[model samples]
Target: MRLFSLTILLAAVTALAGCNFKSVPEPQVSARDAEWLAQVPKAEEDIRYARYLMDDETGETPGTIVVDTKQRFLYYVLPDRKMIRYGVTVGDEAYGWTGTSRVARKAEWPNWNPPAEMKARWPHVHPMQGGPANPLGARALYLYEGNKDTLYRIHGTNEPEKIGLAVSSGCIRMRNIDVIDLYNRVDLNAKVIVR
Candidate 1:
C-alpha cells in the first residue's frame, strides 16, 4: 500500500510539472524611445537587471501589476498564465507598504514635485522640470485607492544602479528603459498589488 501511494503521488507531481506554459514576449521599444534609451549609460554587469517572461505564480488575472518587495521584483501578469518579470527597487523597511491600488494616472518624463514628506526629509529638494536629469526618470504610474491618492508611485528612476534593492522612500522604482516599456504595457485603471 505504501508503494502504491508513493507511485500515485509521483504521477500527480509529474503531471503538474508537465503542464505547458507559453512565453510572452516583451513589448518593442519605439524609435524615439530607443534613441534616448541608447543615450542612457548601461548598468554595470554586477548591478544590471534582466527582464524575462516567466511562468505566472502570482495567481492574479492578466493585466495586474504585482510588486514583490522582498524579492525586489515586479511582475506584469500576461494572458495564458505567463508574466513579464522585471527587477525593481522597493521602499526600505522604514517606509515599506503593502496594499492594493489602481493606477489612476500616468505621465511621460514627468516633472518632480517632491512630496511634502520627502521635502521634510530632504529640505533641499525642489520641484524640477522633466527631462533625463529628473529623478523620476522616463515614466510615472500613480497608484490610487479609489478617489484617494496613496502617495505611492511605481516610477522610473534615474538611478538604475539601485535596481533590485530596497532603498526607496515608499515608491517602486525601475530602470528608465524598463519603466518606459512597462508604461506602454500597463493600462490606466489596472489593479496593482504590492506585497
Candidate 2:
C-alpha cells in the first residue's frame, strides 16, 4: 500500500514538473538581415523606419513575402520560423488591393507610365523616364496574377516621406535603398501576399 502511494506521488510530481517546463522562444530576426536594414536611410529626418525581427508562426515557407497593410509592414519569411520585416507605404483604402500574387518581372530604375485614368486626372503628367525623379525610384517588382499583369507593383519611391503611411496610389512603396536590397533577395515568381 505504501509503495502504491509513493508511485502516485512520484507521478504527480513528474507531471507538475513537465507542466512547468517552457520551450524557448525562437529568434525573430537574424543579425545579417538586421545589418542590411541598418544601411537604409531613414524615411524622415527624425523618424527612421527600422526593420525588425519577429517570430512568425504563420506557416509561410521561407522566401514568401507577406504584406500587412494595416501595420505598414512587409515581412520576408525566413527559415526556422523567423521573419525579416521592412517598413512600407501602402495604398489608401480607396485604392488598396488585398490578394495573393507573384512577382512577374523586375527592373532597376523602372520607368513610370501613368495609367490613362491618371493621365486624365492630371493632364500635365506624362510617362516619365526611369531615373531618380521617377515615381518608381530605384527598383520595381511587377506583380502578376496568373500570368496576367495586375498593373500593381512593389517598387521604390522617390518620395521617401511616404514610407509607413497610407499614401500610395495602389502599390507597395519602399525607400530606394531598401527596395534595392529587396530586389536582390527576392526571386522571380516569388509568392506575395497582401493583406
Candidate 3:
C-alpha cells in the first residue's frame, strides 16, 4: 500500500509537469503590438456599422473597396442591385480615387511598392516587404479589370488612426482588425468598384 501511494504521487507530478506549453497564435503580436492593439476597436454588434455590414455575398458585386476621403462605401452590386453599404474614410479629398476596377487577387501580409507615381508624390516609399511598419498591414486585395491592372488595391494599414482619414499614399487602407474582418469575406476575381 505504501509503495502504491508513492507511485501514484510520482505519476501525478510527472503528468502535470509535462503539460506546460502555452498556446501561441501564428504571427504573434509582441508587447509593442499589444499596446498598439489597445487603440483599434474590435468589431462589436452595437458598433457593427463601425466597420462593415456583411450581407449574403455574391459574385455579381464581388468584393469591397473603401474610399478614405469622400467617406463612401461600395459593395459589389450583384445581378439584383443588392449592395452592402458601410461607412468609410475616403482618401483625403486631396488624394482619393477617381477610377474603377475588380479584385484580381488577395494577399495576407502583402509587400508594398510605392508606384512611380507615388514615388514622385512621397519619395519615401521604396519597394519593401510588408511588415508591422509597412503601409500595407495584414492583407491586400489587388484590383484589375479584364486584362488591365488598375494599379489599385484594398489593403490593411499600420496606421490605425488613418482608417477614417485620406492620409494614405494612394491605396485604400483599412484598420488591421477591420481589414482582417474584411479579408475573410472576399475571394479572388471579385469585382471592386471604387468611385
Candidate 4:
C-alpha cells in the first residue's frame, strides 16, 4: 500500500511540473511608439521592473505612488502588500523639489511647453507638439497641491538612457514604456509622495 501511494504522489508531482502556465502578455506598443522606442537606447538591466514586497515601513496606503528620488525608483502600491516598482530619473539637485501631492490631471502624448525660466536660460526653447518624438514621450501625470498646478510632473521621457540618473529640471522622468504601464495602472487624483 505504501509503495502504491508513493507512486501516485510522484505521478501527481511530475504532472504538475509538466504543466505550462501562461503569464500576462506585455501591452502592445503602437507602430509610432515602437519607432520612437527603437530610436532611444535600451535601459540598463538594473533599471528594469521588479516586484517588491512592501511592509509597514511603506507608510502610504495602497494605490499611492511613492517616488524614492535618492534611489531613483517609483513604487505603485498594490493590494496585498505588493508593489510594482519602476526605475526613474529624478530632478537634479538644483531643480529638485520634494513634497506630497496628487495627480491633478493626466494627458497622453502631452505637449512640451518650456517654462519662462527655462526659455530665459535657453532662448532656443520652444513648445513642441505632442507626439512620439515629444519630450513628454507618451504620457504625463500633472502633480498638484490643492487646486494649484505645481508645474512639476511625473511624465515619460524621450531619453530612456536617463532612467537611472538625476537630470530632469524638476519632473520625475520615466521610460516611455514604463510610464505607459504606470499611466494605465494609476488613477487621476492618486496620492503621490516624493522622498
Candidate 5:
C-alpha cells in the first residue's frame, strides 16, 4: 500500500510538471478573419509573375527598389548591374502615385489599420489583426518621405490573382512568397522609386 501511494504521487507530480501554468491565452479570431482565411489559395504563382533575375535597366545603385507601374513590376537592383524582378500589383489609374520614397520600416505578418481615406471610401473596412488571412500577407515595407509616412506599402497580398494588375488604392502588392523573399533581402530605409 505504501509503495502504491508513492507511485501515484510521482505520477501526479509528473503530470503537474508537464502543464504550463503561465501560458497566455490565444486571442479570439473574428468571423471576418475566418472568412478571409478561407479565401487563401495555394501559393502557386503564374508564369508571367514568376520571380526572375535579369539585367538592371533602371540604372539605380545596388540595393535600390525601382517600381514600374506601367509594366507592373518591381526591381531590386543588385551589384554588377543585375536586378531581381518580381511582378506586382500597383494602384489603379485614378489612385496611382509616382515618386521617390524610402522604405521607412518593415513588418512581418503586419496588422493592418486602414487609412482614413480608405475607410471613408469603404465604410465596411475595419482594422485586421495579423495572421495568414491578413491582406498584408507575409511581409510589408512601409514607404515614407522623410519622417512622414505616405501611408503606402509594398506588401504581400492575399489575392494572388491580382498580380500584374493595377487595382490597389495606392499600394504595391506582391504574392506572399515573393514579398517574404523581398523582405528578407531589403533593409530599412532603402531607396524606392515608383514610376
Candidate 6:
C-alpha cells in the first residue's frame, strides 16, 4: 500500500508540472507616453545601485504605497504625502485581491517555491525553481503583517504586456526593469495599500 501511494504521488506531481503559459511583455508605442524601456539609456551600476530620475519631484510626498487595481498603478507615497505612480500587472480579477500591508523583505533573483495549496490546484504546473525563467523575475518585496508572512509578494515579472492586465494568481508584478527601479526607491518599512 505504501509503495502504491508513493508511486501515485510521484506520478501526480510529474503529471502536473509545467502547465502554465506565460509570455514576455512588449513595448507599446504611444506618442504621449514614450516607451519607458527605450527612454532609459544604459548605464553602469551594481544593479544594487541602479538609479532612476523621477518624472516629477517626490521630495514632498509621504512614504506610503498606493496600488489602484483599475488603473494598474502603484504609487510610492513621497515625503509630503503625494505619490509617484508606475504601471503594473496584478492578479487576475478572479484571483487577485485588495488590502494593506508592509514590505518587510526584499530579494534579488528571488527563489520560488509554489505553496502546497498552489501545487494541489494545478497538479501539472511547474515553473523554474529560480532563474531568469522564474515568474518572480529580478526582484521581490515580501509583504507581511506583524510577525507573519502573508505569502504574497510585490515582485518583478517578465510579462510587461501583462501590465494593466488582471492575470496573476495573486501577486503584484512589475516588469523586471521597473521593479528594479522601484526596489531602489523603497525602504524596508514602507506601507503598501492595494485597492
The best candidate by TM-score is 1
> Considering every candidate listed, which one attains the maximal lDDT?
1
Model 2: worst 10 consecutive residues (lDDT sum): 20-29
Q: Residue 64 CA error for candidate 5 (Å)? A: 0.2
Predicted structure 4, TM vs. truth: 0.79
Which has the higher TM-score value, candidate number 1 or candidate number 5? 1
The lDDT per prediction is: 0.84, 0.78, 0.58, 0.80, 0.84, 0.67
Q: How many residue-pair clashes does candidate 2 contain? A: 0
- Position 171, candidate 3: lDDT: 72
Give the per-residue lDDT of model 6 (tens digit) for 165-190. 67888888876676776777788978
Candidate 6: 10-residue stretch with minimal lDDT:
44-53
Poorest 10 consecutive residues by lDDT, candidate 3: 44-53
lDDT of 2 by residue, 5-41 (tens): 9998898768745643222232333454345335444
Q: Global lDDT for candidate 5?
A: 0.84
Q: What digit string (tens of lDDT, one per residue) describes model 1 on residues 11-60?
A: 87676457543333555766755676666666763322557676898999
Writing each residue's lDDT as its tens digit, candidate 3 over 1-195 gives: 999999988987686457442221223455655555554444432222244334434344434443324654434332343444443445666666666566778887778877888889867769978667667777788878787877777876665554455665557776665566566667677656665
In model 1, residue pairs whose N, Cα or C atoms come closer than 3 Å (at least 3 residues apart or on different chains), thus clashing, are none
C-alpha RMSD of candidate 3: 15.5
Which digits, one per residue and each the tens of the lDDT, describe model 5 over residues 1-103?
A: 9999999889876764564212112224347544554567765566556777777789999999999999999998989988888999999998999999999
Model 5 residue 176 distance off true place after TM-score fit, in angstroms: 0.6
Worst 10 residues of 5 by lDDT: 20-29
Model 2, global lDDT: 0.78
